[model samples]
Target: MSTLEQTPIGAPGGAAPAGVIHDIGYQRYTGPRLSRRHVVGALYGHSLRTAFGLGRSAKAKIFPWFIVGVVVVVAAALVAIRAQIGQVVLGYAQFADTMSWLVIFFVAVVAPELVSRDLGSGVLPLYFSRPLRIADYPLAKFAALATAVFLLLGAPQVVMFLGGAFTTDAGWSGVWNEFTDLLPGLGYALLWAVVFGGIGLVVAAITGKRAFAAGGIVAVFLMTTPIVGVLSVLPSTTANQLAGLAAPSSLVQGTGIWLFRDALVTNQEGGMGIGDFGPVYALVTVGLIAGCTAVLLARYRKAARQ
Candidate 1:
């Protein structure tokens, strides 16, 4: 009665072969195909999660989450201090300036994991086989990294805002003043995210080896600052001020000061004061971000073409 049957083969003196190709009612996919936009969105979400060490092994998550935990604890402590002192010990505008190194470290560690891993593992071809375009890959990756960095930098500022608002004694007016101050702080944080995220991703994109990429990112951030610091002390004030532009961190801090129209506070670490360098720092910051992005996109385009 059955039209299908199994066949067995074996050597004359050996046991019969045992295997079956079953007709278990497998079917071809008949669902609507997802468009390239959907694919890019999915990739973006996935890469964003990866940046924060979400959906990964505990070992993989320790660095990013530990950095996050440290920031949260520091913010909580600052809030408590502010409440007790009845004065702002750490203003939101200075938060990024204070924590810039940790942010740099985070970008160094995570950016390589996102882009370098894909390249090093020889998986780009597989990614290319999907509905995703070449440009879409880097754009999505950059967006994800930038978003992760933004959250890392922005969350503490939010905490600071709440802390400042609640501790103010002048009721709603105090809260309003604090809110006004917070807006510029948040804007500065976003600039840090974009600039740092762009540089980190571009460095990572240059190499497939995660170790090398991470090292390159760190060296670029760490080495340039000291070099600029040395140069800033030169006898020539113009040379000293111009030297500030050499360091990415300084550029970011200078841009923040310029954009926020805020005075250079003692706690702020990088760059010459806004008075010293003015809008050149901001222009250079924009240039650095734009240049890195162009290089990243161009690298991906070449990879996609090949």
Candidate 2:
């Protein structure tokens, strides 16, 4: 062997050599780090955009905008109906009730887009690895979804309000009255957003696959609604009153009727039959939101550790 080939590759006698660091000019960031609120706000805004498919591909936007279009068109039609017939066929609260199916569809489509994808992409742990607390991730998402749903329901109501306000025969006073009526409708919409948004996000978070998440969300909403109908028809008075508790839609509507019976229920006979259990409905609404939020936070906490 040659003299060079006879030598060990490392130090003398085949010992390994120590590694040396190669430094190009490198600098550490000395700038101030963003606070938790900024992170929460970012998550909230990004999630809100995702809820409506903003900044996403065209295909991603089609469904959200489609639902938006449908609701807006319906609002326009209601306005036209008012102008031509001089009758309010769909009141503000009723507008939300009329769009319940669309709301369900929107939540089904959107909740999955918000969280399921994060779970599927395996980025939730990465999210939790940062300054974001476990609750922050889900709560921020819930708020975004709730806000999106509020806007979804509110926009049409605004259209309805504008139509009513402009054509009022009583001048500004009538406009003020229309505005007052519309406030409850907006509040009711927020209630819907809270209940629906909370429940939908919980379902979506359970499954990583967006397709499955969406299906489960729809199934949850659709399945429970029939229970209300079945329960309301039963002979027992207690059962009839509590029937609205079965489905989220009825739960929210029951609460609405409780809070604003004069607006939502025209004739006494056509009411939701919640009876004296209206307070129960309101309580359940609060409980359902709290429960979902708790479950969501728990789920993310476990997921973060994993």
Candidate 3:
């Protein structure tokens, strides 16, 4: 009658075969794709909340200002006691160099916490069960740490640059010049952040324990720099980016200094600045970043299944 009279399957009675419930159950179990956008949004919100909470903490609020006050008091005392204090203050213009410390420490220590905690605590599995995907986790974590580092480390350089421009003999035009000059330096810093952040992520994913991951990252990074720094001095072979073992900051800073030196040498051998470093450093920095990202992703694929 109605298609209910199906074709026979080994019988004259022309009956339709029953569907398997196990197949239906299996179909129901298929998971959803992890959404990158969702992960990013969630991580962004989380980071903001954490930052805000830290800002509200009484100890945190007092600690920073206390350090600033101590530095200012010391500077004032130095100025009153010694004429060289003025020179020292002027040399403070090179303060941006100190940002490398925070960049290195934050990348090696803080990034791993953001990455490994969720996975180690089983939160990642719950997140994966939702609309969020596994791939999104690392991307979101990377974005969060990069942004946090920028805000924490880069923002100070920006403020100092502006402060120096306005408060010092450097006028509006000088300020603009300095700002333009900083573009390359900031670009290198950003690339280093990404490279190190990726290394932290890979270490976290593989290690699973936050403390071990963080400590191992810091130790390895610290150990590598000195070794590379010594090796860089060897005759007949200047340390290229490869021997650095993915050390982006050292490579960028070193290369940037070299570019500045080249610029100065070409122009009456003036004092070398960051501008001496050429585009080659920038290119190599980008390559390191991309390479770290690729390794992180490949390692993540394995981590996900585990």
Top lDDT model = 2
Measured with C-alpha atoms, the lDDT of residue 69 in candidate 1 is 91
Candidate 1 on 1-306: residue-level lDDT in tens?
Answer: 223444465445455545546576778999999999999999999999998788999998999999999888888899998888877777787877788899999999999999987776667777888677778889899999989888887898889888888778899999998888888777878888899899999999987689999999999999998888887788977877677688888788767766776533543344464465767887888788889989998998777666
* Candidate 2 residue-wise lDDT, 128-163, digit = tens: 766788889999999999999999999999999999
C-alpha positional error of residue 107 in candidate 3 after TM-score superposition, expressed in Å: 2.7
Residue 147 in model 3: lDDT: 66
The TM-score, computed over Cα atoms with residue i paired to residue i, of candidate 1 is 0.88
Candidate that scores best on TM-score: 2
Pairs of residues clashing in candidate 3: 34-133, 259-276, 259-277, 260-275, 260-276, 260-277
Q: How many backbone clashes does candidate 3 have?
A: 6
Deviation from truth (RMSD, Å), model 1: 4.6
* Rank list by TM-score: 2, 1, 3
Candidate numbers sorted by lDDT from highest down: 2, 1, 3
**TM-score versus the correct structure, for each prediction:** 0.88, 0.90, 0.64
Candidate 3 lDDT over 55-111, as tens digits, reads 356753453344334434543443343343322242221333344555565555565
lDDT scores of the candidates, listed in order: 0.83, 0.88, 0.54
